[model samples]
Target: MKERVLDLVFLIGVLFKGLDGLLELVGGAVLLFVTPGQVQRAAERVTARELAEDPHDLVANLVVHGAAHLHGRSVWFVAAYLLLHGLVKLAIVVALLVGTRRIYPWAMAALGAFLAFQLYELIVRPSVAVAVLTVLDAVIIWLTWREWRRGRELRTTWRQTVAWVFRRPQPREA
Candidate 1:
């Protein structure tokens, strides 16, 4: 039952990671073609709707602020950021799903680094999205570490069993 639950968690992480990557990729591509004015206009519409529903919605306020900041900004930097992030995430998800033992440690390290960055960003910006992502990354890191340890133990046990079975018998001729 415990193993099943762990498997489920890992599966959910994989799915979420893949979806996140896809969204980033698509968003980046869209940003390449869409003008900042268009983005701001869309954000304004969404923000207005959200604020109408909740007069004091923090996210809506953030959206308005972000849109205002985007008005004259160069979006290439953001586009590049999104594309790079998306590609890395997709690669990690694929590696994990393929059960690459050597990749496990690297994956954990990459995720840990990203998590640390996100935590730092949260400290500076304090967004709900970043906080949720940090939590998800923490869960994935734990699950990946657990799976890596289990794989190592299994390999060690198999080696020991094989060695014992194939051991040469001492000379018994009397």
Candidate 2:
């Protein structure tokens, strides 16, 4: 059914979000533990072969350039951001998968705040990766909203069914 398909897509999105969060956690740890100079050196070492293969490789050059500019303050900021964001996202994912009514609004609110921040970032400083993330978050928000609405409808139906089942017989009619 269409509803099942939508639910499946939502589940997939949540899993993807969790995976991204896990990657962010690992990246944060790496950034936290490694010195800027060491990271720059590692980037150079890792990209040397690729650069050699393709002298004008965009990705290799970007990595080299980005690593070269990594500063201590920026590294700390990014590490903290990643670790916190990852932890929050993983927690939200767990809440979403558990099928609870009360948690959805909180999760949606958290995601909405993230989306707002992302949009502001996009306006101030745009990047392909950030744009992709923004889009994904938007889609997830819409899907989550749909799920919340569906849950409300299901709850209403369940309550009505229970009420009807428990309704008293009319003595006057009898």
Candidate 3:
């Protein structure tokens, strides 16, 4: 009976992980759609900065030279920022999924940790959307690391089978 209960708990945990993965997939898709343009502009601005530039000075310059001119362009600016943010997040999720074959158990534990963090954020300290997304990204990273350690063997076998099926025959070496 205890073993059966434990099995149920394990199954529930797996289901929860699946749900978390799905959420990440959705979030990633949304981010991809929302985060490219703004990122480009931000990247451009950062690239323009010389070494050892003070952050406050940079902000002041941006507000004066960039934001000041953008009173009429605020909506576009915001849209670009959102899109770029989402795209970066999407990229992270993709990377996590890619590594899953090598790290399943670790992935499961990390997903649990992520859920715990989200509970804390929602119940104890509500943050802005950006901060929440950042937390979610951290959780995904943790999950990926966990999966890497636990899923390596399963991944190896799967990979070997795939190679066997698709591998081209080579001529005998002289």
Top candidate (TM-score): 2
Winner of 1 and 2 under lDDT: 2
- Per-residue lDDT over 1-174 for candidate 3, one digit per residue giving the tens place of the 0 to 100 score: 553343334333334445555665554454445444554465456645642365556444544344333433554544455444434434434444465453454444544554565667667756455365546555545534443544443334345545655679999999
lDDT of 2: 0.81
TM-score of decoy 3: 0.29
Clashes of 2: 0
The C-alpha stretches of model 2 lying farther than 4 A from their native spots are 48-62, 152-174
Which residues of candidate 3, in runs, are more than 4 Å off? Answer: 1-71, 95-128, 151-174
Off by over 4 Å in 1: 71-74, 152-174
Rank order (by TM-score, best first): 2, 1, 3
Better of 1 and 3 by lDDT: 1
Q: How do these models rank on lDDT, best leading?
A: 2, 1, 3
Taking the tens digit of each residue's C-alpha lDDT, what string does model 1 give over 37-106? 8888888887887788898998888777766676334588778768878888888877766645888888
Q: Could you give me the TM-score of model 1 versus the true structure? A: 0.75
Position 79, candidate 2: lDDT: 91
Q: Ten-residue segment with the worst summed lDDT in candidate 3?
A: 3-12
